[model samples]
Target chain A: MDPQKTGFDYSTFNPSYFQHLEQRIKDLDALGIQADLILFHPYDSWGFARMGQAMDKHYIQYIVARLASYKNIWWSLANEYDLMAQLGQKPLSAWDFIGKTVHQEDPSGHLLSIHNFYDPPVHKGTTKNWFDYTKPWITHLSIQSDNVFFVPKWLDDFQKPIIFDECRYEGNIEFGWGDNSAKGMVDSFYRIVLRGGYATHGETYIDKPNTTRPIWWAHGGILRGESQKRITYLKQLLATNGFNYVNPMAVQGPHWELAVGESPDKQHVFAYIGDNQPEFEIFDFLPKDNIYSAQVIDTWNMTSTKLNERIDKNHYFHIPRKPYQAILLTKIN
Target chain B: MDPQKTGFDYSTFNPSYFQHLEQRIKDLDALGIQADLILFHPYDSWGFARMGQAMDKHYIQYIVARLASYKNIWWSLANEYDLMAQLGQKPLSAWDFIGKTVHQEDPSGHLLSIHNFYDPPVHKGTTKNWFDYTKPWITHLSIQSDNVFFVPKWLDDFQKPIIFDECRYEGNIEFGWGDNSAKGMVDSFYRIVLRGGYATHGETYIDKPNTTRPIWWAHGGILRGESQKRITYLKQLLATNGFNYVNPMAVQGPHWELAVGESPDKQHVFAYIGDNQPEFEIFDFLPKDNIYSAQVIDTWNMTSTKLNERIDKNHYFHIPRKPYQAILLTKIN
Candidate 1:
């Protein structure tokens, strides 16, 4: 009942408010952002088919479904729905209904998937029934794990490729922020890929409403906006030329010791990781040994660009680190 | 308004309810663990401290302070206050006020903490802050790690030994209710302590609200009411003889190939952290290999349990383990 509190509020409605949605869609059309990931939270929208009393919440839910019907929108039923539901919390049902409504509304094709905090169970004999195949359905998860649970648990069974909505929790070279915890990220990347899968190592963030929190935006400092570091790093990396996603099979590994990103042709690329010994985990996942160039991106400055020159399996890297740093390697065809 | 449908109803309040508070305190003490965490919606009890009701909803605060006045009842304040404030969805005043008022009420020693979906920041300077030892406080966190924030960050630095107020996020393991997910609890116990700090790894049940989860009651399915395996294992290895904690400094160089526990008198009591080659980092931390006995109890379990059969470290240990479990070793003082 307390609007400023953290549970579901009954007022974020007003379906007639769709009056502005048309213009908002047109505005997004000009931005060229490609797609809007609309994470649907119906219960939060105050719309419940079960709630027969208030027409306001119901109307608001309708407007939400209608707006998401516009082009350039990908519908993630709800952000981390599995986690929420498992915790015995209620979310909006409008997601499944929204997907159906979006198709009936526009029909050009609307992407649908549940934005889960981890690999959602591909229900018994219902993997296909769970998501829209028009676009990839990715579940957000952490790549900062010692074991590669994403691929086997979710991706391997999916008909469409699964993108790791959130593979890394912290990324960046700044202090205060979690930029200092990259070791786990670098390790998890290869572990996921080498086991055969795709994941987006994106960071997530939250901010306050009116005032501002340093790391996040709001005074309460909860998740609200886009995670800055991973987004920036991703957009830049994807923009680079001659770089492509690597293959899991390409790496010769008994147990992948590195994270590698190779070209589509497997001709030009590089893989590496960081550990106590300036050594990288690359060889653990690679098949070929006749190496190209080897470099160590100082964790302190990932943008500096340096190389360890030629290296082999017999050697342990000599680069010494005081902690809170990493080693990056680059290679070309 | 719709209590059955699950939202808290607020229209039922009567101001005269507070005049009889002395009895509420008596009841709480008598019916302690029998009750759920008293849900403190401060705005519900006391209204109009009036910081512009326009900005927040902190009315039920008096109730919390009043309840804390009684001994033996544990409680969680408004579920997720941060998210509520953001949507203009809830009363900001409750949080704003409770943040200040709870201290005034619980000054005589009571457990306190917020149940954030993820880990929230510890208020920097508090008279009864978790770090300052002003009081024994707990952070309400989970085990499955929903899309919220990370849990380890809070557990590692939390001052009063931490407790996983809600550890059921991992209820469904490996996509099913019983797919070897129980291993997760074990792995989590190791991960929490080895990587960071102490955790009272208990869980909640829709079936048994009053009873502790299996981990706490069963001890990895061993005892009927406690986790003997967990406690005994940790005590022997990490909290050697209860005099001191196992330290990270015991590991000599990079390999982190070893881990150790020593007596306050500077004698090695345990060391088994390495690969097949046995890179015990405790070499330097050991006290001149003084005569001692290394007793490997249940060495068959990969999580082998061994003990320092004596009071010194002059002995060598050859611990054989089962296929998949943790191996524990102890040096006799």
Candidate 2:
């Protein structure tokens, strides 16, 4: 796969690659998708993973220089840098060079994070002090575990945005990390959001034996999964409502998760309950003296129904019998 | 109200109380249910939770003296003992006294453990060095979290028997800890067993508003939940198949959990695939040289079907498309 040794010198600096990437970014931007541009990944066998320091630095500069103008582009240093280290393939100095080069060259200072692999010695990358949240170059925390319980710890540690980049894919593949039912994927999405974080979507449905090689998880082509439509609904809701003000609140139940968003003037209270029927009372979390018109939101169906009765801290309203439900309490003033 | 303050001088030493408890133990023993007799609990409002040290010591001795004769009696010093300390109701010395008194007085030396409640100052009880597994009084570790991922950590920490006595009850109660669905409860049961630990079962389905106050969780009554049947199936399978020798094995997938069990003669391999439709290759975990007959076990439905084909490391077999499937490979010598 080394074209340089064959006297062709096929490099990432080729003008055709950026032209294609630029077109892809524009197409994604039109669809309201942010391009998470992973500059270096360890999956390649073409000697691209173990590139020399000088070539790596030049490649990072060229990529960032071309893509930094787009507002929708995010700079991901590598797909699984820890895995690269575990293979005894790359050195920390090379990763530092690439990260620093990307951070310094990109004028937009777009969101930057590195994806991680699970279990050590592959997980040793994030344990280093240089990967600390104090580092200004890294914009957010990107993790690849189904353990959402670590969300709070990372939130407190980083004090930055948390992105669950890989929380298992919605597909019927053989591998554990990639095979999740549509319902399971949807539950993970709600969990990440309720924990005050962002989640990435991926699918790996094996179309046939040898035909499904370029899957959505690796190649990123057509999304032939059910979660996309539901995620779009959530995205639209977040965009329409005051989602920026929302914060994850400590909930008492083991199965239930809660998030509250209220304006400074306290006109509305948005509470999101996750993965359980809302049969319990949320009256204590509501304002004591205000009469509020409440609406129960069926998350899966993406429908909201208004109640005829007014609710206050003293009153209890019936929560619909469903797996996942939310209530929006708005001050009627 | 305390009868002692009311001039009646009622104590735990009442012969009538012992007679009733003895009868209850005999009944439980007949039914093969080991009674986890909690001598002290924080929920008691009848002055039982805040008994003085002398009275508590006497209570523990009298209770153990009568109950130790039964083969099925296990001493649990307190239910949520940490919660008692958190409420500023009981001191650590009192707990130490009760634990020590029970361990010394009980001649049967039945399994002894202590249950812990979560959150701080309630969680502070186990943080002390006295609660360390090295303490001879504590025979096992009792925990109450849905995080089965911590099972390995506790296993390593205690080096003793680990019993997940309360990993949330199966019910629709308002409290988060007591309201897991039957399916969720069953999954937790598998997780506990796969991790080489013991789990306890309890039911909390609300019968009515005020009329059904005697829940199976608190007062002993008729069991009213769906998980009992499934748990019984698992119990019988484990009992017949020598599941005690099995250990949790490291699995690569995010959704899949694997446990391997082999008979004394190495004639059988029981691989438990948890929480995923088993579609992958189990060839690597199979004994490469031996031909084995495989059966797919549907844990929820409690059914096992034998496949016509024999399996080895080279051959892949079809697994049914469903969550929570297990495969048993017995040596076809």
lDDT of 1 by residue, B164-223 (tens): 443332221111111112333444444345433344444311122122444322333323
**Shift of residue B135 alpha carbon in model 1, Å:** 44
TM-scores for all predictions:
0.38, 0.87
TM-score of 2: 0.87
Model 1 chain B poorest ten-residue lDDT run: B120-129
Candidate 2 lDDT over residue span A1-333, tens digit each: 342553434354678967998999999999988998887777776667666787777778778888899989998887777777767657655666677788899888898888766642122123342245457778898777665544544676789888888887887655666667676777677767755678888887765334537677667778887778778877676656656634554433332435444544566566666554335554555665888888877777889899677877765555654665667777886
Off by over 4 Å in 2: A1-12, A52-55, A91-98, A120-130, A150-153, A208-212, A252-278, A307-309, B1-12, B46-55, B91-98, B119-131, B207-212, B251-275
lDDT over C-alpha atoms for residue A38 of model 2: 84
The lDDT, on a scale of 0 to 1, for candidate 1 is: 0.38
Candidate 1 error regions (>4 Å): A1-16, A19-39, A42-71, A83-106, A117-149, A152-154, A166-238, A249-256, A275-291, A304-333, B1-333
Instruction: Give interface RMSD, every candidate, in order.
Output: 20.5, 5.7
**Residue B163 of model 1, lDDT score:** 43
Docking class of 1: incorrect
